[model samples]
Target: MSLIPKSHPRAKSLLIREKLVLGFEQGLVAREGLLAHGRGEAFDYLLGEKTNKAAKQAIKAAAAQILLAKLPIISINGNIAALCPKEIINLAKISGAKVEVNLFYANEKRKKNIIKILKKNGANEILGINPNFSTTLSGLDSARRIVDKNGIFAADVVIVPLEDGDRTMALRKAGKIVITFDLNPLSRTSQTANITIIDNVIRAVELLSITCKKLSKNNKNTLEKIVKNFNNKKNLSDNIIEIRNNLTRRSRFA
Candidate 1:
């Protein structure tokens, strides 16, 4: 049972921290990931800890992009695995995207642990584990460069939730459409992505899955239109404005 009461003002945030702490204890999260989450949490606070209109727009565009893609892959890491494994699987199922584990702090044990949790959450074919099938993504020297031959390497669209800037740029350079979830609209990952959902991943993943299901019935032309009308730069700019507006509102009550 969660020690955090739902009535607590910061209950959700506290629970997220608890999960990451447990994930670290389980060998599913790196120490670096914990620090990363703290950074994102600060940005989350700036956004009023809620999904904004701009993020919803980006999610819709992202769903359309995923549906239109010939090959879509959702990249997973320790933080994502710890936070929302089931949501990731559902998004893949709804969007026809493959699930692949790619980590910055890659290791066999952690990979197995992430895969194990994913499988437990209903994922059937998790990739990026076997070295024999791993192919190097040019322009990246981190362990994240090693991608499954049949997954991110060959995918046309990739949903990298909580991604790093270098790999996002590398994927874009390799002629792939990159979609990512980031709290900070100014981050390179947010700017480099073809579609950027500026919201908490725990909320964004579920919202994306729901959006994909709703958009699945739309015609190809409609989906293409949604994708075409979206401008990542503008969407990110709107998010920054939302943060500024939110901070201004909070200051009034202070």
Candidate 2:
């Protein structure tokens, strides 16, 4: 029944592209989002579309941060919503965090459509669409500057999957604990995040959701310990080494 056959050589990659195209057609993703998805797919291919050990560790750290925060908010954009709406909603429910729609490409209609998609996927409460509820993340002039007063602005911890660099820096400057999913470990968003999972957003969110659910029964002390022991810089370095090793192995064969 699927348009992309399961037996195709590039089935996984093609499916990912198809999802982004569908997202754009459904008004759940921005036009620029297709381009971003392509960029991420390139890295995903290099990484073999597998969650590396370092990325798994980062996911654990992100889960711990979510469990440890007094008020955690999951920041959603069009790409994220389109790709993993149900996963995001499930993670919020498991972690007891709020869901807020925050798009870098700001548009009222797109925002509303994203919210509708999330709601359909079981997001009971969504924020970040009210003009009256707007607040600025200081030292940024992008569309990401606008945030909800009670969403990203008020939360002590925030999860930003498929994030932009400028907003990642601004969130850290605002003194919020930031977690991000970025394919490029060398990217600004990865470097700026308090915890960066160097994996595709789909795998990152799925792993984060599972980890959060597993840690749900654990106490705050356990969660805090996990967060305290995570090393962001080392994780980034490990991912870089992974990519290099893969390339070296390929070059030797060639």
> Which pairs of residues collide in candidate 2?
none
Question: lDDT of each prediction vs. the true structure?
Answer: 0.94, 0.88
Clash pairs of candidate 1? none
TM agreement with the true structure for every prediction: 0.98, 0.96
| Predicted candidate 2 versus true structure: per-residue lDDT over 1-254, tens digit per residue | 14988899998778777887888999988888898888888887777789999999999989988988899999998998888899889889988999988887888899889989999999988988778999888889887888889899999999988988988888899899999989998899999999999898887788888998898789889888998899999999999999988888888989
For model 1, give the RMSD to the true fold. 0.9
Candidate 2 lDDT for residue 133: 94
Put down candidate 1 lDDT per residue, 62-151, tens digits, no spaces. Answer: 999999999999999999999999999999998999999999998899989999999999999988887899899999999899999999
TM-score of 2: 0.96
Off by over 4 Å in 1: none
After best superposition, candidate 1 residue 154: deviation in angstroms? 0.4
